[model samples]
Target: MSETDTDATATGTPDQRLHPWSWLFVLLQQLRQFIVPLLVLMFAGRGDHDAWPYAEYAEYAPLAGVLALVVVSVLQYFTYRYRIGAEGISIRSGLLQRNLREIPFTRIHNVGVHQSLLHRLFGVAEVRLESAGGNKPEGQMRVLGLQQALALEQLVRHHGSGAATTTGIAERPDGAAPAGQAEGRTLLSMPLGEVVRMGLVSNRGMLVVAAAAGLVAQASPERMMGNWLEQQVRGAAGYAEQLHLGWLGMASAALVLVAVAMAAIRLLSVALALSQYYGFRLIQTQGRLVVERGLFARLRTSVAPRRIQAWYQQETLLHRWFGRRALRIDTATGGGENDPRKLRELAPIATPAACEALFVHLLPGVQWPPAAWQGVPRRCWWRLFASSVPWTVLLVAVLWWHLGPWSLLAALWLPWSAYAAWQQAGRLGYVVDARLLAVRGGWWSRWWRMAELDKVQALQLQRSPLDRLLGTASLWLDTAGAGPLSPPLRIRFLPHAEARALHARLGRVLAARRMRW
Candidate 1:
């Protein structure tokens, strides 16, 4: 069923009140939290004969459970009120202490309606209201009939006027019409095909490795086997007493092969898990993006479009060959251990050109330059070369001393290191136009990022000892959201004077805009 249908029924009228069954559900949830401890107590007291130890606890169990259940039920009852006001929706909740959170009409990003298996069976659903404030989520309003969720969503949109606001800018203005409506645009959605495609393309290989690890731990064979292997290796190394060099070589080869296989299996399992967890629909609704994916426990994350601080596009050498790149957008909200809102990746990699086009379409006001800007100084090349050479020389010297003639293989590092340094130095570029500052960098996979000059939070110039000798400096541009900085974005190996010029220009732009950053 659709999300809207669930909310209406879940938020029953005041006179009607919550369904009596909801109390039971809340009680059960509270009890579930203590299930493990209860089981442990039961098992520990199974054969105990102390009258006060086990018998006294058992005697009080029923009363204690009832009191706890009642207290929680009452708390749940008061903690789960949803009301619609003329200005906005206010959800009053909290068990021990009370929390009254009001979602003003203007603050609402999107209204998310969802259903789990349990809710489905009961003809109910949960409703989530997302906002840009990045506050903790209030409890799910359980058993909302579908119609209510939809009505609330509609009501929010109707009240939230379509008037343009400066806060909603995702990209700098570029004279083109906004890609979608600012007040009420659907950002993303998934048909059944997209959902299934997401699932199928997931990397489930990692799950296998995790399962194997669990099995190995349960079997308790690692310690024994590892010790035995260690002894065999030591014996082999000192085998002049009894064994031949040929046997030692063969044993070592076998051991190395086994270790390699184990590592490969572990890596494969992790990849599989990532694929499974992240497989689902990423839809846009109003001011927020919704991500729904997971195998066992379904997750629905709502991220406000305006809260997105930065976008990162990454591609490994292999990914480039496959014509795919990974896109990551950072939002203000810090997603927790399993933060659903923090990262959204599009799998089935899109080509760099296609990815850039998609980004432009999603983020209004951002533009990709016709060609990458390349005004960086020549000193960047030498800076990169010098930084890498010292490390290369050290590694070569160490290997030559340690491995004799076999160490000649270390010579390969010099040329490869130089080539890598050149590639990295060549990739950095920056462009500043009337409305925005764009940075582009990457060797195998390129990143083209544009931010409104006004939105830059801070700018920093840094120079290492090597950078000083080369007369170059690194530039850092900070934004207001959560995400790591990138290279072209870093202004790495740019001449000191040029770096200051860019920094001053950015500062002047912010000042003209009256932006604190």
Candidate 2:
């Protein structure tokens, strides 16, 4: 059959089918989702065969299920077809349901092209198109020629920028760029050293260890894993006793062991970071930003600046020591679930100056990290300290039960807590201008959240009984695509009147401007 058969005249392009191996990819995807359940079914069937009348036939159940899925995948591969049009793409699928979806280029907020090791071996890629307010990808092409996939991504991007009026793009089917086409300027690239630095500054290794331990403890019966850990610790203690080491020597040995473990965790983090971001690069091309990374499974994702609803910058104590900051953006691409496909990281690790330049370039009129910050009320410090009092009291109570007089030593924490609260409160501040509003908070781990006035979807002024008593209020700004854990776009501990004035001013600006995303 002709590859470009003009069967879809309305789209001004030929209806195209996925790669011949698309069925295999689809089957693999299905298997990945059900592999654990399939394993459990097979084992249970084998172990309990003697308990049921048709027990012997149970062994074949998983095989039968696999065969059925294979048939479904083949049918889906043959039935699915798509056409690229001037302004949008059309997808048709399903045999009985007969589903047809048309997604406009303008509405497509993020385009993700991924290539797994298997796909790379077959010279194919998977393409996912996401639009605003979607629970899943608007379109997912499981297997396409790598060249064709990139061309489709380029087509959508160009159309979004009004650079295309037809289905064609300046790219060859074999993956050659059009002659004289300007290659995008690279905004940031991570070499192995930087990746290692990022790994050193992150706690990914510790998180992995904690998650693995939790999983082990949950999976084991009767606290088997915990018992094993306790036995190992006792064995180590016995070995130390056999060595006849003094208390000082034992302490030194323990310190050395702890240091070694810490080193190993840091190394693990570096390895993980390298695997995920070996060839990371961010590029700016034709009014859009593209990021490509990964060592094993490569990803190339692109998004328009206009689609970004909010900006986030974070600098932990480690980040400050390493002179790096992480920048992320909230985009209109919504998958309802925590979508890994979303383009969140603009820069995973970069110097503060580099981040500033990127902000200036992407958001032409807005200043970053706001030059001047207005501090929160001093009473907010007292409020913060007071909130910690109950927790401190609880700790002291627990300690006193364990060691009567030692509980008084825990009271020393109150003074440290008060100092920390004072420092954090001093760092809590907000800045605003005609085009941007930003809030900065945190003491040891600093962060800034900012958004354009036009992107602010709602404004809220909150006053609690305690806040009222302290003559303080909070002003919160809401934006599209902001996650529950995202740093609140809020300025807390403002004087009541100041919060009202700021809220009213922001409300007026939002009312006058139309939200772009």
Candidate 3:
């Protein structure tokens, strides 16, 4: 097909028609996804002792399976054809009950291109279009070539820009340089060395925990150490029974060797993290940032500048001692079950003084509060300490009851909790300036998150019974995202009056922007 014809077919304009094979492809894709599950069920049914042998129904079963597949495939084919009109995209599908979905072009937040190993081999990729009106309205427009994907993204972006336009949101400038230009733009082209470095330095504490859990499960925790000890004692007793001092000494030496080997195996469990997170890369795309990492199965995620709800500069005690901070940006996208796309580390480690400069260059118009606004109140520490007491006491009591006299050691947690609370309170700080609001907190691991004032979706000031009694209130700031990315922009314990004043100030700022628009 000609390029123009291909574009028209891929985009499906109001007057244009879809490819004849599009619906067929969708049906096949759905069938492929279901085939394995169907086979597993068939096998499971055959294995059941109470169930009749498949041989009894074999003749009808094959025919029934074939008929079922045909009917489902036909229904899916009819449902998969989608059309693009001037206002929005329309999708129609369903078997007995037909359903139609229409999504306006204006509601689209970002368009993502996803290519799997199979897709790369086939020279096609999936295009996922996400909208701001929650997850329900979002849709996937699938399987297009690399060039076609780019054209579709541009077409959707520029659909309503001309005289027919009714939406107020302006089209992104065509010739304008991509968003991250001034901030040291890295292209689809990233150095292999940097990618390898990123993977090595990433925090693998979670991986270590996961491996430990897996090993504990496999070794039978209740008898694991005792079994090893018993084996050692039996071997020593057997050697002692031989009544040769030289042989006994040699056996003792062998026990020392076994001890060293066991210690090495335990150490290897943590070291396995190095192999899993290998070959990670942080690349700056034209209009977004891209992170590609993983060893066995690689993962790639791209986040647009506009979709970033908050940016966090984090530093643990070790990081602070090393004069380094990690930059993490939270976006609204979901990364599926095993993976998390919440906070993508931009730089694994960098100086705190350089963080703001790098942030401003990447995302323009972000403002930080003056030095005076950075101080958190001293009373916050007392509140944290008081709030932790109940939980600490309950935990200690449970340990004492369940673990007997040995559990008295759990009392040590009380002092640790107190220290953590004190440190967290000290780290908590809020910065409100002309253009943004930044919240900072965390005990051993420090975090400073800044969100643009204009992007603030909602702001709330609340007080619990205890907070009210203490004359302090908590502020909640909600932005556009799911879970952690949707964290309160600021949640520090502040004086009731001060919290109210801050809320009012933010409300006024939002009101003024709305009025201007």
Estimated TM-score per prediction? 0.68, 0.92, 0.68
Clashes of 3: 0
The true-versus-predicted C-alpha distance at residue 424 of model 2, in Å, is 1.4
Per residue, candidate 2 scores C-alpha lDDT tens digits across 1-517 of 1222233448567778898999999999899998987888798788766687999988788998899889999999988998878768878787776677777787888889998889889989999998887677888999988878887887777777778645463225554334464668999999888899999998889999999988888888977987898998999889999999979888999999999999999999998888777898999887789999888888899999998999999999999999999989988886653565678888899999988889888998676656788888765788789988998899989989889987989889899989988899989988889988888888888998988888888889999998888788898788888977679898988888988898888887787775433
Point out the higher-scoring one by TM-score: 2 or 3: 2
- Give me the displacement of residue 302 in model 3, in angstroms: 5.0
Model 1 TM-score, all chains together: 0.68
lDDT of 3 by residue, 305-342 (tens): 67777777777776766566667665665443133322
- Which lDDT values do the candidates have, in the order given? 0.57, 0.84, 0.59
Better model by lDDT, 1 or 3? 3
Among the numbered candidates, top TM-score falls to 2
